[model samples]
Target: MRIVFLLCSFLSLFFASELITPLPLHINYDKSKAILGKKLFFDPVLSKDNTISCAHCHNLQEGGDDGLEVSVGIDGKLGSINAPTVLNSVYNIAQFWDGRAKNLQAQAIEPIHNPVEMGIEDTKALLKKLKNNGYEKLFFEVYTDGLSLKNLVDAIAEFEKALITPNSRFDRYLKGESILSQEELSGYELFKSIGCISCHNGILLGGNFYQKVGIYEPYYADENLGRFSVTKLEEDKYYFKVPTLRNISKTAPYLHHGKVTSLKDTIQIMAYHQLGRELETLERDLIYKFLLTLDGDIPEILNEK
Candidate 1:
């Protein structure tokens, strides 16, 4: 009853005003710093074995994710959770599925320190390597302090801030610069009417808040306790930071576990567990089509020399 009432309210609000907004075409950042960060992002030297880079799990060219159910890290270590797309992540209120990191800057250096990820145990050793490998000069050019961990992650965060994807068909439609097909339009209506907007409303269609994965029913039994891991509260047990829908179709194998590969299956699961409702075949198809329209243009920074 509560969910139904909220759904009705959200549906009404959707009609009254825009529930989602378009991504800006550009965001300001230090180009020199971001360029330096880009180099560091792709550099393997950050890893313990120098075999893994941020791009190893996040392939910027391909949906900003590695296209794997679980990320493969340094020494072929398997990550516990699926790798979320880095595109448009700057807008997220918090970072990671668990919302453990407060922001991009906080999230940047985590992988390097994670044993299963980049695994850089000795910070001083890593800094020494950076100084010898041309990064010191780059750091000097970008920051007066030269090479340091703070500046390192700061530059990487700046690059990440420039990773916003804009100009999706839906965004253009929202701006009255383009139009959606009737089916897509209907799908959008269904998305709002069916309570998806209750949790997914915002410029990113999510990422603004945390929500339980199994609001109406249990989705799965896993060791990961989502936000509970960070908060250590029983109430937070299945709650996760809502992911953005931008490039949803491309970031296959959805959810924190990434157990479901097909988008249709993922939708069905969300409908059953999150909404406690079953979607008809046509309805699911329509919603899927609408979601495809959410894919946006790649960040222009990727092409910058």
Candidate 2:
């Protein structure tokens, strides 16, 4: 009887709709590389002015974003797009809102030299600087190429890859360790019924594919070209990579430009603009509760800082 019950539980998950999937309990990554990368991630030496680090924009404490409408970077320059959360970014099909960089390594390289970001002018000079700054032994031990750009980014990417935050309320429910409250369960049903699951599905909820933000209505934001900047295809215009909802509650000022600050308002906007499903006030509240279930504990690295 016990074997039959356990097998039935396993089979239920397999037969269920693929609209939602639970995140793994934890991520697996190299400890040495992740540690090296963590130091580099928090080090502002990678910045031109020695004032900005990746954590400045993507602070792990604040849902992996700096909690600003748009991120302020090196030399106190403001960037055009909102800094997406680093938490669960490994699940994203591509990095960045534009999906320009193929992987995290490529994505990691750009911000170092981005004029509006870290503002590092020369790569070779930066590499030389890091080595001279007593990082030679660290890089050499972790990577065969020593302090090369590839090794630097790889170490950083390893750390980024380990940024997944699992074991949220919804994840616990999915794993059958806990149960959702009545309100949360209602919200979950509404979420599936309202077609939100169409795009926001899978392990990360919404990062697996690209979708136009305003399918039912036109989305107006300032100079936000999205994927068109990468592909230069007309159809690709306004198509941006949907961000993961794993830690959505803490990642405020939502969207590409960080235009929507309030979670409640953002929900209504997404429904009207993307799904064309006008939500009742109570319905919106329920959905909001469900979104809160997605919130997970912050990364341990952030707690140390």
Candidate 3:
């Protein structure tokens, strides 16, 4: 019995090392471009009515999401999907819930053009507004070509690249710099042994790949077809890019549909629908405690004046 326990422990450690990694303390980004992008991200002039900005949906101050079931856009228009957290978004394999946009640069300009979101009707008009609103000089400071739509999104992407949150308690524990509580440790062990680590592995812990929402049971289908909208493939239906679990505690109103607000309920739902298991109340509680360790320090870039 003791030998069996030691072998299990050894295998667990091996899988943990192969499956998960600690986030880096810092990543490279063009600071000047990111600073300019920060300004543009908060500026409402990008909208047609000049009332909405990127920050309106992605509130960097908390959770990197707006805390809405679905985002409210320009002129009180409601979006179809929940806003994914911008925190550590740089690590995602692709952007948006649908994976429609290829990268952050592609993702940055999308809401500006979406009718219900930023609602910019004319690219030329937006350029004029930016030039008149002192953005031309800012663009010149960062880019030799001055202001343009390409550069605009490029700068925003650069800023998003710097939005990685590092040094979470889990990450410190992974690095052997800190230790988890007994409950947290047990919860993490369950996380790996129970197959959560199969999909939710990697630095950001679940952003690395796409997965179908319901495997064991049927999750209710909605108008949003997920990646099927992007690829037009039958197999792609209901397959969305698995979101990062980093800061899962802060970004409430979980999932692509944003139907579940309680993290415990979300856990139960995932267990039943995805894992085909019904967790006891105590198991859910311990998993919740483990998840809390994922909340990390805010990006230092947000602190820049």
Candidate 4:
């Protein structure tokens, strides 16, 4: 057992020189605020009709998404784009498909007043309702301000910050604590050699930067000419913030539009569209298995709650 352990450790160190790094086991987050945020996240009171919460779209139990192509908002109002997983979302450069919101705190409040989403007729009324529901004390307990928009977004953002799923199988492999089969390792090598790592690098593996969605060819999505609407720059058209693949297997249907449902198909389409190369059947299979290793445990607050 000791010899086996040492060999595994050596291999981990040997293979740890990849582009992507492992997520830390713990993240710094405000616990009391996060707890309040958890309640807010799960509570359906945020919507105008009392039907939708933030969790309505990003269901933590279902890989932080509601298993829909485009998440519906209050009163069956359809949102234009796919709802990205909230898990590890704090790692993103910006929020939303067009990168509209700059941070999670900013992102949390948009839906509340949006005509489609939470659809609150009045923000003040929502606060008043929360206060009436005795959330004032809860908010005061966390942020002396209590139940205000600032405190609400802050608390919710704190919970999101703690949503990191550390120590995936690939992360264990990176840390030299676990072994990858030859097929998995081969797929990983292909992942590196084929240039997937350029955008899909760093701890969150693809959230750090924006890239053209279809470098080799034009890609049409449900978005309004991709990021161009945000920047109003013609050059920015067709560009998208590359999404994290941290829990890729769970957070499907894939892409900004949720167009592809199958992991194999997404991989193949990406290889051809982004890399301009079609992966062989064996290569796609191996890579798919490797991507599966990204699935890991959710945050402790989610489990404990």
On TM-score, the candidate that comes out on top is 1
lDDT of 4 by residue, 1-305 (tens): 33553354345444546658888899888889899899999888988989999998998876888788888999899988788899989889999877889999999889888889899888899899998888998887878666798989998999999898887899999988757888888888777667666657778778776677777766776545778888999878887888888889888888888888998999898888877788999999988888988887777788755
Model 2 residue runs over 4 Å out of place are 1-16, 300-305
Residue-wise C-alpha lDDT for candidate 2, range 147-202, written one tens digit per residue: 88898899888888888787799988887865799999889887776667766778
lDDT ranking, best first: 1, 3, 2, 4
Per-residue CA lDDT of candidate 1, range 1-305, in tens? 45664665556564634778899888999999999989899999999998999989998887899888889888788998999999989999999999999999899889999999999998999999998898888899989999999999999999999998899999999899657999999988888778787778789999998888887778774677899999999889888999998899999888899888999888888888888899999999999999999999888988987
Q: Estimate each model's TM-score.
A: 0.96, 0.92, 0.94, 0.92
Better candidate by lDDT, 1 or 3:
1
Per-model lDDT: 0.88, 0.84, 0.88, 0.83
Error of 3 at 64 (Å): 0.3
lDDT of 3 by residue, 1-305 (tens): 33553454456556766788988999988999999999999999999899999999999988999999999999899999999999898888999888888899999888999999999889998999999999999999999999999999999999999898889999999989657899998788778766677668889888888877886787874678788998999988888998889999999999998888999999898888877899999998888899999988999899885
The TM-score of candidate 1 is 0.96
State in Å the error of residue 273, model 3.
0.9
Q: Which of the two, 3 or 4, has more lDDT? A: 3
C-alpha-based local distance difference test score of model 2: 0.84
Off by over 4 Å in 1: 1-16
